[model samples]
Structure formats: C-alpha cells, structure tokens
Target: MGWLAAGDQYEVALIEGRVAARATSGRAAGRQLKSLPKALRDHPEVDRLRRFAEWLDRHAAACVAQTDLWMVSSLPVPTGLLARVWPDEAWQSALRDLAVVGDDPDEVGFLRDATEAGELRVVNLDGETVRLSPATVTLPHPVLLPDLDDLREFAAELGVVQKVEQIHRATWRKPADLADNATTVTEFSGGTYDSRFALAARATSLGYRVTGGYATCRVRDTGAIVEASVWIGEPYWDDEVTTGGLSWQDLDGRTLPLREVGPVAWSEGMRMAAALHAGRRVEEGKDT
Candidate 1:
C-alpha cells in the first residue's frame, strides 16, 4: 500500500500487515521509523490501517476454515474455482502445499499454483513440477490417501507446511475382525469429565456438533452420508458425565452395523470420539 500523509512530518502505510511510519522531513527524512511515531499513534491513517489489518486476519482465518472443511469432506473442487481464488493471498495460503488428486485418482501431488486459465501446477512425489488441467480436483482426507506416509516424508524433505492440515492428519482404519452384528465401538467410552457442560464444551471446541446427548460428526462416505456420534450426556444433565460408545448412523437415522460403515466415515468417527476422550479430566501429575 502507498504511504499516506499522516501529518506534516510523518507518512504512514501498511507494511507486511503492520502499520509503519516514515519521517517525511527533518533528520530522519524518508527513513522508516523503528516504531510508529507518537503523533501518528492516533492518526486517522494509522487507525484505518489497523482496521484493515484486523480484517485481513479475519479473512485469513475464514479462508483456512473453509479449506479445512473442503479437506475434511474430501469434496471435489472445480479447477475454475481454484483459479479464481488463487490470486487472493488468504485463499492461496490456506491451499498451498495441500495434497490434491486430479482426474486420475492414482496421481497425487502437492499443490503449488493455479493458473488463470484453470490449470494447476503441482510437485509430484518424484519432485518434478507438473501441470494438470483436470476439470475438478479433490483435496482428499488423509484417511483416503493411499500414499500418506510417502507424502509425509516427501513434504518433510521439501519443507512443505500446509495451512490446512492434510497429509499429516491423524487417521484410523477399521479392523477386519469386527463381530458381525456389532453396531458400536466402546474403545473411547467411559472417559470422565467434570460436568456435562465441560464435555459438551470440549466437543464444540474440537469442531464437533453437540446434538441431543451426543457429540456428532457427519461425513459423506462413498456415496452415502453417515453421522458418527458419541454420547456425552443429556442436555439438562449438570452432574459429571462419561463418554458413551461411539456409533454410526445412516441418513435415515438408522444405526449402521460396524461392517457397513465406510472407511472414511469410520475413521472420522473414531477420530472425533478419540479427540473427546483425550480431553477427559485427568488427575494432577498423572501421565497423560
């Protein structure tokens, strides 16, 4: 942004997301000040810049959140949409270095850039930059990535840090030995919290919805929508509560047999249950 006249002696502007001032006259003429001059502290220009910085922070956070939602849902994003938003720094930051799959599901690459013409440039596992013009791409959930470990290793080698968690996201796989009629997993049950409110608060803070007495996460698995829920406590319960068994339900609210749950849904449900369980109040000095 161009420097604006703040006062006769000072000019101020945003520099690297911060308000900075430079002397317009005197001994320090044209030199950037180490700190904003006292006179410009309350200047209109300074206040405007500060407000703009605050807005930028909010925009960046919203971009990250939207990107996270896309990844978590493994939704297919149009190439045109990516091209349109690539010029925005906030959007770019949230998308850069994320693992993306093009039309060919087998081909995985780290997103580097999206062109105005709807082409994507990405770094492949082999460390070569390749251009792809697929109509749509998927920022797949880590649980669905076949080469997750290799991608993680390659990302480390290249110093890639994704603003939206992707390759390094925690994932779980369904065990092959589940009983035929089992409908719930009790592995994360019995986690104690000080109060029902505290348990519900933890679920909300972790991005899960508290519906009825369950902390729930809804996911689209394969072609079906499934909701994984872990019982926390009834809405009016004020006393201490323990997490209940985790289970999956179909769109019609029918309890799904463990064997029928898709891989992605199973993993995401387990992830949610485990996160809530992890927050259970622990005794002081006890190993977490």
Candidate 2:
C-alpha cells in the first residue's frame, strides 16, 4: 500500500526552456515521455476508436438473434439487409459457411459472401463459387437443404454449430379436423438425427419450447389450440436416443383425450416423431 501511494505533488517544470515533470517533495526524478505530443483525447481517431469498440461489443449477440429470427420464422431476408450488415465481422461469421437458398429453392449452397452489388456469393456442392442475384435469400430448414450430408460433413469439419434452428425446426402441414374419437400412435425413436441434441435443436429452432426433456410446440388444431410434446429422453448426446412417448396436452399439462386432440396436433406430433425417428435412422446409416 505504501508503494502504491503517491508521496508528493508533481509539477511540469520548464528546464532549459523544455517542459519536464518534476517531483515537488524530492528532486527532479521524472524521465521524459516518449514524445511530447498533443493530447489524443479530442482527436478524430479517438472518436473512431470509441465507435469501433462499441460496435464490437454489440455485434456478435445481435447477429445471433437476427439470424435466429430469420430462420425460425422462415422470414424472407432481403439481400439488402444481408449486404448492409455483411461488412461487420460478427454478421459475416454468422452468415458465412451456412447453406443459403435464394429465389430458386432447388439451388442451395454455402454462403461465402454478400457482395456490394447486393448479390450473394456461394459455394455449391461441386465446390464451385457462384454469384446469385435474387431479390431475397433464406437460410432454409435443414430438412429442406439439398445435399445435407455433405453440408453436415463440412460443418463438422469446420467445428461450427448452427446458432439458428434450420435443421431442427418442425415442418408444418395443412390442418384437418379429427374424427369424434380418433387416436394415433406416433413414434420418434428412429431418425437421421437420433441424438437428444439433434431432435431438441430442430424443435427449438422451429420455435418450439424445450424444457425438462420435453420439446413442446403449440399448434391450432381444428379451431382449437393445443400443445404437443415429444419425449427426448435426456440432455446428453448418446449414440442412440430411446425417447419417451409423444402426447398432446392442454395448457395445464393435462393429457388431452384422443377425441379432443385435433388433426393438426396429431399431424404435428407425428411429424416430430417421424422426423426424430428418421434422424435416428440416419445416424445408424439405415437411410444412407
């Protein structure tokens, strides 16, 4: 503490007509600064540096949230939006290396860049870079991605986890009314992505709420709103996931009667189960 304390007042002295910092309590024991330049506090470069630091602080989280919203809602993100944010490092990192589809949904490729001219630069499966001039581009759901195996391999090699829920989001179908007494058994135990993380990731990406090992999605079934949930077993990554049963429930977590479960809930529950089962099979190379 004594060493950290300032012992005496110091003053800038004019020694031989040159400014020098001298100790008032002792002798002139100060050394010269590297350079006697103007203070940098008010310089233009200082303002630029401050702004850059602020941008860096907010960019990464902002990019993650925006990209998630874009994917979950399947929102058609304008090329202009991508172009405007492309210059930021965080935005570029989030958008790059992920598969993106433009106007032609059939043509999917890894996003390489957002060009200044509002075009997208992408690398296709054949390993060729192509420029696309589409009005809008989207990061498609994983199930919709062409050449998904290759993309997954590439992503694994890069050690990148998609922050958005493109693969795991639930696919939707037209709603239909259930019979007065209808019941169905949906199995989600086999699939391409049978891992707990894989199934939950997809459901969560599709705007489903994952909690307590249940990946829940709310849907409107024949004019009535119901919640559907799938048992994802556990939280860890396993070689195989022996998921629990799937069910349709009400807001209070009470199981709905078969007759009360509508067609949409049935379809969505079956879709989740089938997708998970498919992922499990995919993991086991049954579908390869």
Candidate 3:
C-alpha cells in the first residue's frame, strides 16, 4: 500500500494490491522491475500479479478449448450464451475475429463487435457490414467451410484480420467411423516450451497452420488427404508445460486408424510432432 525501499537502488510499492517497482535512479529508473531473484520477487504485490497472470493464461486456454469443442462437435452455440460472456475480456478476446454463421449458414462473416446490450455486428463475405439477431452462431473451422479462400480475400478487402487464427487454423478431417478405426501416429510426452507462441512459431516455420491451440497440416497420399494436428499448450504462462498428443483425422473430422493411414501421412505427421517435441524447453523463460 505504500512505497518501500527494498534496497538503495530500488523502490517498490503496492499499486492497487499488486506489487509495482522501479529503479530509484539510473537508466532504468521508473521502469518496471524484471529478472529479479525468487526471494525478491515474492513481494505481496508481485505475487498478486503472478496469480492474475496465471488466471489470464488459463482463461485463454479455456477459450480455445471451448471454441474447439464447438468446431469439433459442429454444435450451434446460443447467441445469448455468447452475449452473456461477450462482456468478459477473456471470452471476447477468444471469440473475436472468428467466422460466425447465423441461422442461414450461408450468411457467414467475421465477428467484429458485440455490445454489452447484446447487439452483434459482423462484416459479411460481400464486404458489407451487417447487423444480426440470430438465435445462435457457429464458428466453423476453415476446412469445414466452403469458399474459404474467397472469405479470406473478402476479409482482406475489408481490412479485417483474425486475431485468433481461425481462418487459417490447422484442422484435420474426421474419419467416417472414428472410434472403431482410430489410431495415433505418434505420442510424445515430456515436451516442454517456454510459451505457446514459441511453439506456434516453430510450427509455422515448418509450414503448419496454428489454430485452436494446435499445429496442423494436410497430407495427400494415394488420392486421399488427411489432416494431421498436434496440440500445443496455451499461449501464455512462462514455465515449461508438456504438449498434447498428436493425431490424424479424415475428412469428416473423425480420427483415423493408424493402420489405415498411408505411410506418407504417418511419416509427415510424426515429423511435425517430433519437430515440435524437440523444441520444448526445460525451464521457464520469456514468451518471445
């Protein structure tokens, strides 16, 4: 609640119940404290900041998880449900920039704004702004949506870009009978990363598309195309966290049987998973 001198060179204070610190004097004076030792960073305010940060990280993960559920299940989410959570920054951040389809399903566009009073705004594929009051909305993954390339062009014309990578997110098609014929290409555990962004970047460099917290790519073999995806953890948080299992799917969004998968598909999927697995870090570090 008050400014205190932890040492002659540093001044720290409780700012709104969170620890804030600055150099007393020098090139770093008045700047935030960083790279301090564990004992020194354990101040009450600092601890509060840390806790809030963790909460934010989890919130982002939850958003991706929820969106993924919607896409995977092909379920229609009630507009009222989106309205209720729209006011929350975490939810809004997650849902923003996604392509939403109303009752017609043909009328698809990018979600631009949602008022606290429940008014929804979107820029349609025709590059015109439209208002809507549909009972529900569905966020379809690009692979599931037709004219995706045209939609991307429309978004570009409208100067709208996705913040959450929905349009370009990696998606795998589900096989017709996933449960009976499903197989995992490879499963790697103990993979570590400083943050999700680094993992995403690594995947992107390898020509994999990131979406819904997973790195994905499509493989064509023997006149059949299958999707391969590997789950990377949430984007925030500093410490190392293990990556999720890498799997393959058919066109219908169902998991494929490993034995049914072509050698090329299997090899590529494992290549992606293994490359990502190798990039994991052993300790906490910077996001960039």
lDDT of each: 0.93, 0.63, 0.71
lDDT of 2 by residue, 1-288 (tens): 001112244334333323333334534345443333244334444344456556665777688767865654345789888988899778987787667888888887777788788988887766678998888987765544666676777666655455554543455442355455544344454344547777777767655688878877776544466777777766776755655567788778778866666554665676766655554544234454
TM-score of each: 0.90, 0.46, 0.53
Off by over 4 Å in 2: 1-59, 154-288
- Which runs in model 1 stand beyond 4 Å of their true positions? 34-42, 284-288
Best by lDDT: 1
Query: How should the candidates be ordered by lDDT, best one leading?
Result: 1, 3, 2
Model 3 over residues 1-288: C-alpha lDDT tens digits? Answer: 456676567767655435567777888887877555355576665566657667777887788667755654346788878888888777887787788988887889888888656667888876777887888887875666778788777777776655456676544443455455456644564587767777888899866888877888776654577888888876564555567787888899988766677655665677678778878774547421
Q: What is the model-wide C-alpha lDDT for candidate 1?
A: 0.93
lDDT of 3: 0.71
Error of 3 at 193 (Å): 19
The alpha-carbon RMSD values of the candidates against the true structure, listed in the order shown, are 2.2, 13.6, 11.7
Worst 10 residues of 1 by lDDT: 279-288
Model 2's TM-score against the true structure:
0.46
Poorest stretch of ten by lDDT in candidate 3: 169-178
Write one digit per residue (lDDT tens) for candidate 1, span 1-288: 798999799999899999999998889999999998788889888999999999999999999988987888889999999999999999999999999999899899999999999999999999999999988999999989986898899999999999988888889999999999999999998889989999999999988999999999988888788999999999989899999999999989999999999998999999999999999988889833
